[model samples]
Target: MLLETHVLQDTDPDLPALLADGFEVVGESWGAEFVIDGGAESTASLERLRGFVETARAAGLEIRELDARDAAAIESLDAESWVDVPTTPATVHVPVSALDVRDWATRGRRAFGALDGDRLVGLCVGAAGDNDFVVVAPDQRGRGIGGAVVAAWMLGAIEAGERSFSAGGALQNARSLAMIRAVGFRVTERWLSLQRP
Candidate 1:
């Protein structure tokens, strides 16, 4: 059997009791959820992301807000991004379905896409009142596409009157953690997901 519990780190919950009850921390990480306060960001991360923006522009990559019409492209990017997630023995291949595409492309969902002459190369999908996920095409890595896309998305979100933002990912995902932190999301909580033996 598998069970999971999400609690605020500040609450000082009883972890020993859970362990004694045959529960083990299957996963735990720092800064799993980062809160983005309006457009406020760490000076360091801001500089980094901005640098990426300039670099991408020089490379002829354009960033823009996306709509329903770009859904298919976003879905394709999603599948490609998922397939490239650093895999391990614990990884699972969850197929992306049509429903998933529709959900990602739903109207009014605040999203952004990066284009190189009309070809979608990156995407930033925002969660309702939550942290958003960013994906850049495999060939697009190291070109600052991921960071630039995120920076643009955050600007758009701020303009839409969203004052708070948060993001979460696996503990081992350093690239994402750095990107989010660069956007000024401090580590507020570390969640311990427990499972039965």
Candidate 2:
């Protein structure tokens, strides 16, 4: 005996449009960056995105990672103290998914926390990738915490067999640029992004 199965097709016009052209609505994502599927969009889409990147670059933004220990302190610092400053939507929050210490530990990535007498004052998260350490955090600003965190992370990365560490900062963010410079991370690339219309 043989059995046949039939799959019902979606009736929504947008569904077909999206599927036929490989377009899909993006969900809310956490972290420093989000990926978009453009499908069959025209050059105009690329142009618009480029314009957005240019504008954001003009606004001064920065991106870099802290040591795992400092990354762990982010939650405590934000919870215990008050920081009076404006944070970019992209820069202020870390995804809960990335904070799974157990998973990171299993994968050989170390998570570290800075302490102020048993209270965590800063945290850092670093991963081994492309022979470099990728760090992420939100509290590495003011009071030289950023540099300290990166220094720790770099040492860990070196011990883990990474020969070099790389990071990025926006042209507009003076504080972040200064912190990265203080830690001796040279500029390697300029990044930009845009949302679809």
Clashes of each: 2, 21
Q: Distance from true position, residue 154, model 1, in Å? A: 0.9
Give each model a TM-score: 0.74, 0.47
lDDT score, residue 55, model 1?
A: 72
Candidate number with greatest TM-score: 1
- Model 2, 1-197: lDDT tens digits are 43221111233344454445544332211112111234444234334434433332343432223344543455446444334322332234343332654356666665444443444544445665222122223453364444444555555555566654445433455665665565544554433221222
lDDT of 2 at 152: 55
- The numbered model that scores best in lDDT is 1
Q: Which ten residues in a row have the lowest lDDT in candidate 1?
A: 87-96
TM-score, candidate 2, is 0.47
lDDT of 1 by residue, 56-141 (tens): 78889988877767777777877877765653223233554445656664444567778999788987777554645678788877
TM-score of candidate 1 on Cα atoms, chains taken together: 0.74
